[model samples]
Target chain A: MADLLTPENLVNALSLGALYALIAVGYTMVYGIIKLINFAHGEIYMLGAFWALLVVGMEQATGINLFVAIVPAMLLCAAVGMTVDWSAYLSLRRRLPLADGLSIGGLTLLGVGAIFYKLTGDTTHAWYSEAAHGVFGWSIVALVPVVMLALSIGEKGGMLGRSLGRVSSDRLSALITAIGMSLILQTLAQLVWGADYRAFPQESIPAWMNEPSFHLGDAPVLGKELTMWVVALAMMAGLHLLVSRTKIGTAMRACSMDQETAALMGISVDRVIAFTFLIGSGMAAVAGVLYSVKVGGNISFRMGYYPGLLAFAAAVLGGIGNIRGAMLGGVLIGFLQGFTGGTFTIPFLVMILVLLVLPRGILGEPQATRA
Target chain B: MLELKNVHVHYGKIHALKGVSLEVREGEIVTIIGANGAGKSTTLKTISGLLRPTEGEIRYEGGPIHLVQPSDIVARGLCHTPEGRRIFPELTVHENLDMGAYLRKDKSGIEKDREHVYEMFPILAERREQHGGTLSGGEQQMLAIARSIMSKPRLLMLDEPSLGLAPIIVQQIFEVIARLNREEGLTILLVEQNASLALKTAHRGYVFETGTVLMSDEASSLAANEQVRAAYLGSD
Candidate 1:
């Protein structure tokens, strides 16, 4: 008990809590807007970690510092997050017909092929390669648009029209898509950067990050932990201000309240959703870096799964859509995990117990209307 | 200021609006009085770009608006106060009003409009810090109208503003609408089930039944029409 009460344990708990809070905000905000649990968000966290590692590796070959790597990693992860929305979620939200989606997807693939054929310019010239590159590319450009145009023209044909009108009603499909996206991201990461854990190059990390910045009782507090706390707190403060004090933030809040009504108010619901993903993913990037640093630079394709699950648990524990709730939930879960043990059993049990008591989590507002 | 020509809307196989054509000139309060499921709300929604018409055109201020997004429609100064007082429940009254001016860039203009809204609805002013959900139904309706007015709209489309309110509150709301039309010269297209109150308040009226217009005339003529009275006004 005395050992648990030590300052060192307290600092560790706070650090862990801060990390969870940072990642949990993404889940909460996304859920707030679309009512979809973005299962792929954990993969975004993983990608951010890998991006940081990749950047750091480049820096070692070229002498760039760790701080400089943060922005690029964040930007790359943000792009991936937005792309996931555009490819998987947006069409479903718009209720575009599957046929339209297929045709559009085909057009997009054709465009990509055309671009590839143009860029590569048939240098190899083997019959299979030429057919694969040239014939397929040139044919798709003409064929796809004609097919799509015909579909558009024949839209009034009852059978085709009815077949094309299948639309998603709820968030279930999006949730499934998010899970599939997570798997795809994980597989791609494994293919690109082997399945084994890669240690973060400590030599490439700045001295300030690796060295002890101060002491808490008998234990020394690492610079990395201090950075995580400061950065996370700062980001939280900034996010709070943005959500409360800005026009975009107000629009976001309005959207979470009622999407159709928000759109009627001239708030671009789509833009706001994308912006939420960007901020959430960017924060996830920051958390990823701090987490990788704290874990002695070890990064694996599967590193994000447990932490991501814990953060999601944190989001639910706080109140899924409530920002402040996520912060509080993160702190509680971190403290529980850190003080009790690294194992997830206690935290998971706490989540279940808390949920059983407060059905909406700690701060989730009870929905007034069923719709 | 707004016109819909041969507009048709479909909800899957259910044709909600069939060749529904209407016009609202600038500074006029035009009302569409209809029974439940008569597509009055659908007409307003299509004009506001919440739902697209399967066929036809919507023109606002001589420009085609059918292809525009809802936000862009609002940005162009056409605001819709939807059927429900869908106020941001968790947001304070002031924040709700702020959201109304989401597309506006002029700080002074937005503030001025906000003040104007408060002046119009003194109850809202008194409860500026209160969460919208905490307000009474009448107060919520007032907030909804006040929120729409915060956009400084050239045309305001209101869908059933008197819904689920007491008689006295309904009178107060109509008076506010009259005052806005009289004083500000605001253009309004109101959809209502209360034919009596709507006809009294509007300059012109359209009577709807089963997704088609049954009659269109000056408000007084519609009020006096025997068919309208028998079906809608509950009069002999």
Candidate 2:
């Protein structure tokens, strides 16, 4: 027990918790606004890590400072996050009656399928078969926008529009779409990066970053751990100020509380949501880079899944929508996980126990009287 | 300053507004009185751009505003204090008020408006650091109205400000509303279930029944109408 509670383990726990807290904020913020789980958030973190790796590789060839990779990685990840929202969630939200929108999407798939068939022209011929398969590969590129336009117009005119407007229940569809997005992102990552674990070239990093900066008793604290702590805390503080003091941050809070009322207050809901994604993903990018450096310097297509789930658990543990709660939960979970030697069972049990005891989490507001 | 011509609104299969038409001239308090589902709130929502009208037009300052987004409408100085006083529960009163001035770039003007709001609802200023959810129902409503005024709206549309409040608190709210309109020349469109108080406060009144206007006239005439008195204004 004494060995487990050593200073080394405490530092490890803090760094790990800081990473989880960073990613958890993304989940919590997105959930706060739209009430969607944003299951693809983990993939954003993974992509950030990969982006950092790619940029670091460039640095090695050109002799640039490897630390400079953080900026582009964060920017790229933010763009990716925004694109995911634009392509997936926003498109569905704009279409009233998610079923109608889905059907239109289905029709577009069929249209593209037909176009592929025409291009193939008798698949019995080897050349034709290859052409058909190639066409099939590009169908999504050709058909998605076409279908979107058709449905958008249909939503604005005639009986279809009226009927579409009648179905106001979009929560279920949005949830399903979120899950689908997770699968799509995971699969795409696998296809692009393969399922192998690629080691980050730690030697390329500055020697000072890799060396121990200080010692606690027998435990030596590496400069990398110190860096992670400083960077994570700085980013968290920055986020807190941005949310609490900035105009856009205030708008985000208002939208989270009541979207229609926020809109009525002249706070553009769409703009606020987009900004939320940008900030959340940027933080996740920073977390991803730090995590890769600290944990064996390896990057994998599935690297984000376990940490992402743990961060989600951290968010829920801290009271999902409360920002401070997420931070607290992340640090607590990180310490607990470190103490337990990275076992899932203890953390999972903790989450369940916390839910059973305080269902609203630590900082959740008390239930208000229903009108 | 605002006109709705044959406006229709639908929520799923329920037609909330059926060709509801009304007008609010500059510097007037126009009240819409009705039962729970009589489309009074819907009419306010349509004008505020929270709900898009299915048919007809909403003209604000001589331009069609039916197609405009809600945020743009508020930016144009049309603020709606919505039903249920949807204040950000976790935000402090000061933060909530800050959110109200989101679109305004005039820092000094916003500060002046903030002072004016504080003057009107001194309780809000007293509890400026308290979260919105901690406030009482009456305080929340005051915060809602005070927050709206922070926007410096040209046309303020309030929905059911007295829905669930003590009679004394309700009276106080009405007094503030009347004062704002009287002193500041602020135009208002007030929706209320409290017909007697509404008619007393408004210059013009519209009686809404089952998604359409049943009558429109001067507030005193509507208060005197036998049908309106029997259906809406309870016998004293």
Candidate 3:
């Protein structure tokens, strides 16, 4: 308990809480628009880190520059993520109504999992090979075009928006979507990433960026932890700007408030919804990468579960559907975890206070209470 | 300015409009009268492009508008203030008015129209910031009319505007409708179960029974008709 009261613990709490807030934004955005608590969104984050690792790993394996390997790595991961949406989220969501699709999606994923484990059971001992040694040189340049293409496709009322819009309001559809999303993503992680923690070494990133420093203070301060928080804060600020100031952002807000009314107002609700998913998933992906870097480790596919839950917890703290609230809630949760984790009383007290103050989860949307 | 020729409408298994046809000439008021289950509301929905006719053509200003999205219909200057006051409850009165003129691009003109609406319904101007949900029933009804007027439609459609309103407020709303037709030269298609008020206010009337029109004549003549008075107005 005394150790937790130390300034070092406080700093750790703040940084971790900030990261939770950053990731919670993605969950909250998706929920705010569709009211879905995407269970597998955590997997999407995990997949992002793997993408970065894959690129850097391939670059090191082959005699390629860091610049060249990044392109294919991001592209491959993005394609995988998009595929996750297309094959699982879109396919099931489109085939039947929401309730039926959720059941079918779960069953189908389980069936696929059994097949995967059966096929790859013997190959578990094999090492990861460098498939693209000396692959083409491309920076994050290629990603811009791909994201733009995704934006365009989403604007055209892509499959998810079209199918879900038919059954219920955007809020209801989002909730169902998150459920289906979580299942598919969790299953994919279990099948592909396996149950082992896989990560790039600390030396993979720039040396200076990875180093931990202690300030000459009464208590210890970790520089590496501070950097992690700075990155998260930056991401949150950027997202806030993206949602508030831009044209697409305005359109997104319009869709969230009243989709049918937005459609009547000449804003294409489908396009806005698609953009929402892309941004949300993309944010989760970015968080995935940064989380790995901060921890100086690789993660199993299932790594997304704890953080996903925590991020969701943060969002609930903030008011699930409210963006600013989610961010604030995240920081609060982190601080609480930092102070009360090893000791029961303080954390328990904080949890009680939060529950009493906000029984609905920190930032949960008000309208979502109907269900 | 709007014509429905041999239009057919259905609600699930029940037919709502059995090949009903109607016309509203420019610069006039046309009212549709009927009992509870008659096709009065369906005709307005069809004309506003909310419902597509099962059979027949809907011509607007001689242009064939057989089928189109509802917003597009509003853009084409045919606006319908729907039945039972479908005001956005969460939004303020001013915001509701803004939504009414959603398709218009001219900022100055829109502001001007908003002011005009406020001038027309001073009560709305006073309650501009208040949420529609908090407003009284009569106030919400007034807001609905003001919202429709903000669209500045060439042809306005009102469905049961007088439904569930106090007698004085109903008279006030009908008076405003009459003024919009007489002074602004705005064509209107009003659907109502109140045959006396509709026929008295409108220039022409159509009597709907079940899903079809049983009689069509000048409003004053229909008001004087023995059958219309006996069956609808409860008059001698």
Candidate 4:
């Protein structure tokens, strides 16, 4: 118990909590508005780490400004998040024909992934000859239609997407589709960045951040821990204000309550939903970058799986649709994990028990409607 | 201001509306009166672009509007207050009012219109911070209308405004409706089951029965007709 009270343990726990809180904020908001769990959100976090790894290469020429990677990482995450919704989730709500996922989701998440990294020296059993090595090694214009043609080969795969969008989108079907999306994203990450573990570059960790002792006396706080807390808190505050005070925020809350009514107000429910995805995915990216910075990138295609699940547990444990509840839930779970010495299953067990006792979780609305 | 010609609509396979036609002139109060499932609501929905016509044309202000989305239609100055007072129940009254002008960009104009709506409904001003779900049924209806008013709609379509309300509250609501039409010259298309009250409030009215308009005439004439009286007004 005394070991748990140490400043290092406490900082680790808070920083972990901050990571979960950032991801959970996005996770919970997506659920709050659209009622889809977006199981692929974890892959978004993983991709964020990989994007930072790309920036590490840039640092060789551009000096050690790896933080600049956050911008492209966030933009990429936002685009992927928004595209997934437009192609996979939203097509169900409107009567429009479905399975346009490849047009943007594929181009950005998969096609763009290929362009960033070469495959010749990376993967074995290479499909290309010596002349065609590493994804054209030059032109993006030549690859667009070929990838689209590959995706459009048959409706057999699109049958699942079309049926889900066209006929029934009850919670069970939606959940299944979300799980499928999660797997597809994982595969995309595997195919693009490989399944090997990558590092966030040692130099990216500023020496000052590595130095311990942020307090006057015996209490020690690494600057990296401070940076994590500050970044997460600032983003969360900005999100809170945006949701509560802005016209766009009002429209978003309105969409969460009832979309048909929101449309009547000239609010354009689709635009608000897209904006929600942009914000939520960006928050998840911040969590990813912060985690990579702190851990020196113990990053892999599967890395986001644990953090994503834990953050989801935090979102549910706090209250699925409430923002503050999600943040608190994340912190509490982070501490629980820290004190238990990485006995991670206990958090799930706790989540199940808490959910059985309170189906809406601690801060969820009693009525099952969004707040 | 609005015209629907031979509108046909199907809700899944049910054929909710078929070959319905009507028109609403500028600055006129037009009412569609009928019993339950008479397609009055469906007609309003088709006009407001909530549902597409399977075979028909909807023209607003001399342009084809049948293909427009509901939000775009509102931006074109045709606002809809749908049935059952579907206000954003979780939003504060002020935010609910703010969303009414979602497509507008003029900051001061939105503020001015919001203040105007507040003056029209003082209870709303007092409860600006309250969630819409907490309001009384009549107050919810008021917020619904006031929300539409904030958009500065040139032609307002109301679906069952007095639904499930106290008689006195209904009277108060009709007075406001009359004032909006008279003072502001706001064109209105009201759908109501209250035949007696609707004929009184409207300049002209259409009698809808089983997805078709059985009769259309001056409101006073429609009220006097024995066939209309027996079927709708419950009189000799």
Candidate 5:
């Protein structure tokens, strides 16, 4: 603990925390408004990094390349985020009667999963002999019918329908859809980019950017790290202002509280929700690019998976729907990595602790808590 | 002016509002009074474009508002302050008021109306920075109405403004309703459970029962009718 108290470690912790906060805020903001966990947010993060890598001159990033990388990355991610929201969640939500749509959606996904499993059997592991390699694909194919059957019985107005209709169709279905969205994004990434562990081209970084320019009380701070920290902090501050001061931001807060009420206020709930996703996804994009640079310039399809999970933990720790809570949670989670000397256990431990002890979260309120 | 003709609304399998017809002229306080399940609130919600009527026509300013989106309806000079004090719980009072004028692009107008609302509810001015949820129930209800007022509506639909409030607060709310109608020339469609209070405050009243209107007349006549008095106003 004493050795870890160094300025270098503290700087690392802060940078890591900034990344997690960027991702966590997406989860919390989505949850705050529509109460969807938006499990696909991790993939958004990954896509941001991937998109940045694809931007013009990123591979040979010299002077201004790195600075300009985030723009395209964020724009692409925001577009995808909004598109996914409209196509996946909105279509289901907009249907006249939710039950029919949910059943059809649930069934269609399962059928598609079946077709994918039947055809490729997960080509990533085609060379391997283990039949379980395609288990994730097979499981979705297998589970949908059972879930559908159980839910359909509720359509006949049984106790389950009366009690669990909102829970199952709205909350549970959205959650499952989110998980499916995450998997779909990963699969799509694999299909397009392949399952290779793609690396951020190290040549993109100017040598001076990686080398320490100044000392933070004897701890040398690299230019890239300084750049990332500043960008992340600025984004956080920008988010706070946007949510607090901007007209759209006020609409977002209103919708988060009560969509019906917001609608009466002449605030388009659909537009506000789309805006929330755009902002959150944009932040994830910035985080993705920054983290890629920080982690030895290596990028992968699965990079966001663990970090996304940790950011979620950070969100819950601070309070699910509270913005400031998410920021605090991210910093705390970053400190956990440093304090534990880097381990997988600390995050889960913190999450489990938060769930058990602080159910509403540190700053979360009873209902519609957004700031 | 607003008119609903043969409006049919359903909540899933249950028909919540059945062939409900109502109207409010350009400058009047129209109240619909009923028991909890009478679909009075549903009527206002349907008119606000929050709930779509399965069948029928809703015309605002002689235009079909039923086909319009809720925000569009509000933008076209209609607003609904829903049942319950529905405020952005985490947002400050000022923010809540700001959201009320969300569709308005005129900055100076918004500022002017905001000051007007603060004048109407002085307590809200003092609690401007406090979160909406932290306010007392009466205060929240006032904020809800004040927030709705910020929209500058030609026709405002208030659903049960007196619900769960003390008599004095209810009186205060009703006085504001009367003042808005008298001074601002604003038309109001009010849904209320307090039949006596609503009848006294409104220019006209409709009695609702089981998803349909049982009676419609001038407020004093409804108050005087033996059956209406027995059913809603009580023996006193």
Candidate 6:
């Protein structure tokens, strides 16, 4: 009880919640578009952290500012994210029907993983060279605009978007695509980053900021956790603005509301869905970088899986498709997990509390129907 | 102007529309009337590009529009207000109207047109901030109609405007339709089960039975025809 009241616990709660919230939006958006929960979203999240780790590692050796290295890292991850969409998901939607695509994608991922393991010797650290780190700063800046433009073309002017324009309903094709996306990304990580637990260079900010402290009734309690809360709040605010104010954002909301109606209105439902996936995956990437920054990346291929589950749980707790609900649910769940650890029957207690308080999850809204 | 020639549409193996052909001239209120499962709605859906005919050609303004996307059809000046008021439930009433103008880029004119929708449906103006899902059925129907008009379509197709409405409310809807035709000179293709109400509202009508056209004539003649009276008017 004394530890629960400490400032460190509160801060940890906030940080974990914020991270979950960020990743959860990806799960929520994919679900909203196609009514399918993406089990592989966690792998994408892990890939993001690994990308940051790779970039930061290079910067550390090459005498470049590691902080400045983040720009290119983000761009690379975004490109990788879109590639995941195209190679795994988009191909599934185009080449074969949905069920066959899922089986093929899953099998292909397994085969690629085996090959990656054989080539890389199943080592995570060997992928990170101890020397020869050159600054890729110019290349990173040059690629950002090009990547953004490519994504736009893929979403808007691409043959996939055009062909699928009329079939605007929630589709099984989308689910198969998501599964294929998961396999492609995980395989890419295994091939490039190797199957190892690589760590980022030692940092002080997480330790210095995560120190907990509290004063209650003139008694001092120590160990504070505020950084995560601040990050989560900031991310939510930025996401709110991006979704509400942008043209693509408006089209996304319109697609969620009614695909047929949105298409008839000329909002380009396919392009909007693709854009939503891109933005949602981008958010997951940001969360990945932040996760590495705070925890000093000891990344695994499946590290994002647990976080993804928590985020999905958080998303459902608030309301599966509601954006604001996801944020609230994440924060609340973060606080719950923070306080419940090592407590009597912690898992059962948490489960009971969630069931009693939010049978639909922390932020779930009720169902709605129009006349 | 729209024309459907020898259209055959099937849902799975069940034939929903069997050899149905109809035409709507420019600047006219053309009503398609029938009993339930008479393929009335299927005809409208095929014409609007919502459902493709298994075999047929749909020509609009003298060009084939059968292969066009639904959005492209709207861009070509044909808009559809779907049955049972399929408005975007989560969006605010104003946002619902904005969605109707999704194709248009003229920001200032779009804003003005939004105001026009508000003026036409004064209740929509009052409850503009409310979600479309929260509105009453009658209001939802009105919002659906108003939202479609936001596209400024040359041809507006409505599927069953009088479904599940009070008699007084039905009268009000018909009045609005009459005013739209007279004042705005908008072409309408109305599908309704209520033959008497439809004839009163439309210039000409086609009576359909089991996926085939039974009769096509001026509304007044259709109203007075003995066979039409026995089959539809429900008068002895």
- Mind giving the per-residue lDDT tens digits that candidate 3 earns over A125-222? 32232112101111122332333233324334776445545344344444444554555555444445444677665445555554456653565445
Instruction: Tell me how many residue pairs clash in candidate 5.
Output: 0
Across B154-231, the per-residue lDDT of candidate 4 in tens digits comes to 999999999999999999899999999999999999999898999999999999988988999999999999999999
Q: Identify the CAPRI category of the predicted complex in candidate 6.
A: acceptable
Query: Which scores higher on lDDT, 4 or 6?
Result: 4
Runs in model 3 deviating more than 4 A are: A23-40, A43-178, A185-267, A316-320, A342-371, B5-20, B37-67, B127-129, B148-152, B183-185
Best by TM-score: 5
RMSD of each: 6.1, 6.1, 9.5, 5.3, 4.0, 9.0
lDDT of 1 by residue, B1-236 (tens): 89989899999789999998889999899999989999999898899998999999999999999999999999899999999789899889999999998888899998888888888899999999998998999999999999999888989999999999999999999999998999998899999988899999999999888788888999999999998998999964
What is the full ranking by DockQ, best candidate first? 1, 2, 5, 4, 6, 3
Candidate 2 C-alpha lDDT tens digits along A1-371: 67688787888888889988999999999999988888889889998888888776722544445578889989999987886776667757665454566565445434533554455343344334344533443453344445444445555564544455523324544555565555555544444444557755765467887789998778788887888899989989999999988888888888888888888888888889999999999999988887888776468767888889999999999999888888988998898898877788888799899889999888876654423
Task: Write one digit per residue (lDDT tens) for candidate 5, span A1-371.
Answer: 58878888877887788889889999999888888888889999999988888763433644446557789899999998997687567754664344655555555544544564566444545323333523564466346444544554554576666678755754565666677778776665554454556555666656777899788888888887787788888988999999888888878777777888888898889988899999999999999988888776457667879989989989998999889899988888988885666676987787788778879888876654322
* DockQ scores for all predicted structures: 0.64, 0.62, 0.16, 0.60, 0.61, 0.45
Per-model TM-score on C-alpha atoms: 0.89, 0.87, 0.69, 0.89, 0.90, 0.80
For model 1, the stretches where C-alpha displacement exceeds 4 angstroms are A1-8, A58-60, A102-169, A369-371
- Clash tally for model 1: 1
Error at B225, model 1, angstroms: 0.3
Q: List the residue pairs that clash in candidate 2.
A: none
Question: What would the per-residue lDDT of candidate 1 be over residues A7-90, giving only the tens digit for each residue?
Answer: 777788888899899999999999999988888888888888888888878225345566777888899899888877776678
Q: Looking at model 2 chain A, which ten-residue stretch has the lowest summed lDDT? A: A120-129
Q: Per-residue alpha-carbon lDDT of model 3 for B133-169, expressed as tens digits?
A: 6787788888888888877888888989998888999
lDDT of 2 by residue, B1-236 (tens): 99999999998679999998899999999999988899998898888887889998999999999999988898888999999998888789999998899899999999999988998899999999999988999999999999999898989999999989999999999999999999999999999999999999999999999999989999999999999889887787
Candidate 5 chain A, poorest ten consecutive residues by summed lDDT: A126-135
**Model 4, range A124-214, lDDT digits (tens) per residue?**
4323322253343323423433433333332234654345443343454446546656666665565555556776666665677778747
lDDT on C-alpha atoms for all candidate structures: 0.83, 0.82, 0.68, 0.80, 0.82, 0.71
User: Which one wins by lDDT: 1 or 4?
Assistant: 1
Misplaced by over 4 Å in model 4 are A1-3, A58-64, A95-169, A213-219, A368-371
